[model samples]
Target: MQNKKLNIAFFGSSLVSAYWNGAATYYRGIVRALHNRGHQVTFYEPDAYQRQENRDIPDPEYAKVVVYPATQEAVYQMLEDAASADVVVKASGVGVFDELLEAEVLKLQSQNCLVIFWDVDAPATLDRVENDPADPFRAHVPQYDLILTYGGGDPVINAYAKLVAKKCVPIYNALDTATHYPVAPEERFQCDLAFLGNRLPDREARVEQFFLDVATKLPEQQFIIGGSGWGDKPMSANVNYIGHVYTKEHNAFNCTPKAVLNISRESMARYGFSPATRVFEAAGASACIITDYWEGIDFFFEPETEILVAKDGAEVAELLQGLTPERAKAIGEAAYKKVLAQHTYGHRADELEQLLLTTPRTATAAPSSADAFVS
Candidate 1:
């Protein structure tokens, strides 16, 4: 896919801020890799003032960042940009005017351009659209040329097919090897177990079951939580709650933990194969990762050898207590090697390019399971 100089236009939430948005790292990684491959990319984001102020990067080097208001003029300008690009992608959960963007972006479909609906949280988005008959974007699924998802293996593709989506593909979360490599451990983040994620309604219960419960069961082990919104929650004496860890601190935070925990949101877990950005980030830092059982785990890493899996608090305690430092290091190294080989942003960029070039102009009415990559 090298030297495939295509102009790509992307519309999504803050690419500069990791404040409340989890897609920042993914957008940065994929966009940078695409640009490095000689594609001209432009990212359009709404004037989400708070996210703008809390941005880790005020400006990104890879893509031309364009912040637009929700006015009529801004909408027209955005459409113009999309119409001119070879491929235009409207990602889910943009935090503002997402319904409008999804419905209208399909209008840019033409012989020279392709329009895609990129679902970052496929499970949540599918739930909303499938359950709610009044969902405005329900009818627009078939209008776009292709549907791309961050995660959700066959479950997501099949669900979109039910909605008569033309074509659906899963592009799971991958590591940015250059940005998320090993780093020296920081004293503040040192702990036996660590879990980092924003406190959201769908995830807090799982965090309690997987993270907080395990912490309570093993009183002697040090557990750390790094993310926003858990401040008011009850904490055990051995547990440490750091309010928020910016993107720059991810490596140190991952490196400091003896074993990092990955607790998928309930929806993602139920659907299976939906790996959060934390999985790749932690693995890239060569941290021994212990994640809850999810389908398609084998697609990314070989469990027990490359990664560890735990079903409940008892298992979590057992794994944490059983592994020696040498064994843990070996597991982390194996996971790191697996991600570098098949689950990096560079790989995703190549997949995207191939998908774009190969997908039919007129998508089939029913989705086929033919186009899928496990990593």
Candidate 2:
């Protein structure tokens, strides 16, 4: 337990909104736990008004929410906040001012504050940085005191280390058992297989391969896709397309499906050990899950017993056809037990606290200018 109450400043996407941003759940779970432990947290976000309006939470009780305009004044205010904080975290995919925030927040490390670049999408960020010589973030990588990632495991850690990152830690996503547990199945999400994810370029092809293709293979089985940007995708007769399932409905959505499908983005799958939030959410609902094969999966859950793995659409179809109700129930139960025991946000909060406590807070050379952040 932390003896002193630390004032943490988090600059990230809308904490109150689940619209478009995938990190809301991650932020909520971890930040809420920290708040529970008697720490003060202030969350800063840009006024992406649409997301704000569609917010699941207008105001988050866990942190002081500040929605600033995308202006130079706002940038300066954010920097001031970062400089004064005990631990300042700039999470990736802020949807606005990401580059500016990353560069400016790194500058706060000189003031003896622990500035961390928390990469929610590590593989995508790594790909852009390593592959693109013009990537802006490459130069800024080594500036932060510590780098924490939601996923990407060793590949991300090793890649960032090569970039001269001071220290890198992979803080994988975990279940918030309190909010995401087995609920009675709902009728709206009832289907043989269900998937919930916003369509992004990196994940679209994999979804087609693992979800749509498999749905086609098993035409007799009812399939449902619940997410945004997927309305444009063509669907088979047996497939139901429920555009976007709100945060409140996730449990019902997870519970309703006989077997939920988890299709990782190409980068995430290649990087491995990157279980999407959907995996844990569905498991919390005790829904049988069938996921595409990815590296280091055994690190999270035992593949055959706790979860099902599919190599291709044919394999997905085979699993769907062969998995008995009893076997599926057993797998779901096993996964739930595993998550409750080892992979909850409470466990992650402890790890995060330990990391912050142990990490050396030595000052690094200051960044040249905001323009230096340019790729």
Candidate 3:
């Protein structure tokens, strides 16, 4: 495969470490991988809060950070910066100025640039578009050259197809091995089972169903929960809640726990193949993972070998009680090996490059005309 060195401009919520959003890690991982492959990347972040609180990761060495204002001037500036880039990616869920950013990115298509609508939350986005046909983004989807999602399998592809996207690809969440690896166990995070995920409305119920229920059932065992929006929840004495853990502390949290729990959001579990970034991160750190049952498990890992699938709180209890330390370590090792082999950002970047190469590119970008080609 011929490697093309493309100038890519990436627009997303916030890269500033202070914001501490999970997408920051996603951007850093993929952007760094693209840079390693010799692509020039420029990242645009318009969220002032993220810029103010940015502490997620250090400024990426491989990419240039362009902090744009959350104003009309910022959109104009973004247009000027993105005009000459071969590819301009607008990632979904950028906290601030995304509506404005999306409008500007759509306008850039007429400049003959390859624009990609990269959705991190495919389920949410699809749901929103389905409920409202007159959404501004709905009309723009067909105009964009490609649609990429962070996770979701067939459901996401089908959703994009409904929007008349010329091509849609699911670039599933992957681990950055360099950032996540086995570490010396820490006493603070020691527990029989642990789960790390930010609290979101769609995921809150699953967290209750999988983690909280499991904690309630296994009152004798120590359980630790990490992530934001979990502070107000009443946790059992056995359940230790650590509000929000930073990325750098991820490995210690993974290594300290005997077994880590993976509770997929309602939509992701239903869709299958929708492994969150935490799955790969835990695997990369060689943490034994017991995940809730979802579709397409075989494609990622073999049940009973590389991973343990749980149906509900009772199943989670069964695993917690039965899984010995040695067996847990072996499972973690197996998962680690599997991830290193097939689920790394490097691998995802390769897949993305292939998709981009195979897709037809056009020099003209008139919105109505572009829609005709995509449809």
Best by lDDT: 1
What's model 1's TM-score?
Answer: 0.93
Pairs that clash in candidate 1: none
- How high is the CA lDDT of each candidate model? 0.86, 0.84, 0.82
Taking all chains together, each candidate's TM-score versus the true structure is: 0.93, 0.94, 0.93
Runs in model 1 lying further than 4 Å from the true structure: 1-4, 70-73, 362-375
lDDT per residue, candidate 1, 1-375, as tens digits? 334588999999978888888888998888888888888889998877478778878777788999888565675567665667878899999887787778677666666677899999999999998789999889899888999999899999999999999899998899987679999999999889999999999999989988898899889899999888999999899999997789989999998788899999899999998998889999999999999988988889999999999887678889999978898899999999999999999999889888877666543232111211111
Residue range 288-331, candidate 2, lDDT tens digits:
88999999889889998999999888898889999877888899
Best by TM-score: 2
List model 3 lDDT by residue over 272-336, tens digit each.
Answer: 78887888889999999999999887788888999999998888888899989999999999999
TM-score, cand. 3: 0.93
Question: What's the lDDT of the predicted structure labeled candidate 3?
Answer: 0.82
